[model samples]
Target chain A: MKLLAALLSGVLFGVGLAVSQMTNPAKVQAFLDVAGAWDPSLAFVMAAALVVSSISVVLARRRSQSLLGEPLQIPAAATIDLRLIAGATLFGVGWGLGGLCPGPALAALSTGVPEVWVFTASMLAGMLSYRWIFRVAPIRE
Target chain B: MTEFTPVSATVGGLMVGLSAGLLLLLRGRIAGISGIIGRALSQPLGDGGWRLAFLVGLPIGAAAVSLATGRLVVEVAASTPVLVAAGLLVGFGTQLGDGCTSGHGVCGIARGSKRAIAATLAFMTSGAITVFAVRHLLGASS
Candidate 1:
């Protein structure tokens, strides 16, 4: 049941991303191209998602366990550090270049695009390299 | 600004939020794509089944909409080498940061996590600057 819920949630997230044009690299690029011919459509997506998530998170946090009785596993890292900033900076540079992040890249997998394959493979390799080098240290539990 | 689709974008955002929110409320987990993927790759046995299920569902979910509406269009605009570099950067950077837009932007902000907020700001600024430099200053569209 829990697994099913997780799958359903994933499906919902994917559909949402697809519907919002988040799967399109061009659309994302346009959104990020604030100084140029900018597209503000994606901002609405982020805003709407945050509104719903903020409310839900507030409600869910009061409970020690989830509705399914799983221990809440939200991030527990409490401090801001150079690692966080530096990592996000690198991710952002890549994001600006390709307009594909973890979620959209995964969601676009079934499209069978060669470029997606390249991006996905490289992204996975990157993840694996970090794991091998860093030993998958839990940055924050 | 001209390519804006407020209705669909808002609806999609709601869906994304619903997914993230539901995951939190039901499983007490952050719907963080990078974290989940990393775990799926290296986590211990009996620990990665759900992550796999979630990851599988990502493509399947998008595929369903494409099959039904036949409206989804996909093409990676960047060159193969560019895409590879971007992917590698994203993959490594997300791991090092411990979150991406979803983790830090959506789930973390919703929870009022300072680290998530800080990380999100850092990435947004970096992304904007990179775009300006690459697309504007450098004129390297590819």
Candidate 2:
């Protein structure tokens, strides 16, 4: 049952990526191309998504546990430092160039574009390196 | 007269929100792409089945949609080298950040996580800056 639910949720996410055209790297690039021929469509999409997400969070928090009987996991830390700045820089530069992030990249895998493989491979490598480096001092769980 | 039927962005938003909710509910996991793929690669024995299925299903779902609705137009405006570089950088960043946008922005922020909030802001701000620098400072485009 849990497996089925996970699969269904993934499918739903893919469909959303498709319907929103978030899967298209070109559209994403256009959105990023703020100085040249800026596209506002993605902004509208982001705004709409934020509205839905904000409301959903407020409502979901009323309950102690989620529907599946697990407590919602929220990040504990709030302080910012060198680690935060550097990570954001890397992510931003990547997004500016690659035009796909983890969510859309995974969703794009279904599209069979060769680019997905490249993105996925690099993303995995990055994660692995993180694990190895943090083996002795892992990120707070 | 009135032929325009607006596809509610809310439908997709709701789908995303619901997916996050369901993933937490069912698997006791966050629907974070980086974390999911990371775990899938590292520990074959750690929650492997569903991760494989979910990752595999992504492409298949898109393919099925293409077959039914017609091929979704794909265009890579960036050069191959640039895209690859971007991928490597992102791969490195997710490690440093400890989570991707899905983990921090969508799932974490929704759960009232301050760290997620800070991370998401940083992510967005940097993304905006990169675009500004690349398009304006560097004068590169595709």
Candidate 3:
């Protein structure tokens, strides 16, 4: 049941990416294109997503236990530090240049676009490099 | 005659929300691109299989959708060097922050994670600034 639910969710997320035209790196780049031919459509999509997500969360919490038979795991930290700021900046630059973040980029691969693979490969390398550089301690749930 | 369907942003958003929520509920994991990609990179014993499956599935899903609807549009205006640099930076950031927007902004916030809230705020601010600098200052565009 859990596997089915997770898979279903993944499919739904993919569908959302498709319908929003977010799977298209061009549209995302348009949003980043502030100076010439700037497009704010992605903002609208994000805003719409935020509203729905906020509401769904409120309702979902009313349940005693989630469908997978476990409580929701929330992050324990609360402060904003150099790590957060630096990370955000890095992520933003990537989004601006590549026009693909993790979700959409991964989704784009299914389309068999060569660029997507290149982007994903680099992203994976980046992720791995972090473990070596930062030496992240094992995260305990 | 073909039926006229409304482009429901609400429905689209709801579907995305549900998908993220469901993943959290079942896998005890946030549907974060960075984190998923991160785990895939480690290639730990018994790890690569699922990660490979997940990674492989993403592109396949898009391909299937494109086949069903129409061709998927892909645009990359940045030079290869710039794209590579950006990818490296994001990887560093995802690691330092311990989560991406999907994990923090969506999943973490939903679970009432204060850290996620802070991280999400930082993510948005940086994104806005990058847009300003690249588009306004540097003259980069799609």
Where model 3 places Cα greater than 4 Å from the true spot, the runs are A34-36, A138-141, B1-11, B43-57, B111-114
lDDT of 1 by residue, B38-134 (tens): 8788862345388888888889888887888786777466778888899999999999999898999888888889998899889888888887887
A6-70 per-residue lDDT for model 3 (tens digits): 55666777777766667776776666555556566666555566666666566556766666665
Task: For candidate 1, give fnat to 2 decimals.
Answer: 0.83
* Candidate 2 regions with alpha-carbon error over 4 angstroms: A55-60, B1-10
lDDT by residue for model 2 (B1-142), tens: 0111125334555566666666666555667766676667666556547776666555555565566668665566567777777887787676677666677767777666776778778877777777778767988755
lDDT of 1 by residue, A15-107 (tens): 999988788888888888889888888789889999999988888878989999889887777989888889999999898888899998999
User: Per DockQ, what order, best first?
Assistant: 1, 2, 3
Model 1 superposed RMSD (Cα): 1.6
Which DockQ value does candidate 2 get? 0.45
Write the candidate numbers in order of decreasing lDDT.
1, 2, 3
Q: Listing every candidate in turn, what is its Cα RMSD in Å to the true structure after a full C-alpha superposition?
A: 1.6, 3.9, 4.4
Candidate 2 B-chain TM-score: 0.84
lDDT of every predicted structure (CA atoms): 0.86, 0.66, 0.65
Kindly give the stretch of ten consecutive residues in candidate 1 chain A with the minimal lDDT sum.
Answer: A132-141
Query: Candidate 3 on B1-142: residue-level lDDT in tens?
Result: 0111125334545556766665655544566656666765665324324344444545555666687778766766667777777677667677667777567766666666777777777766666667667667876543
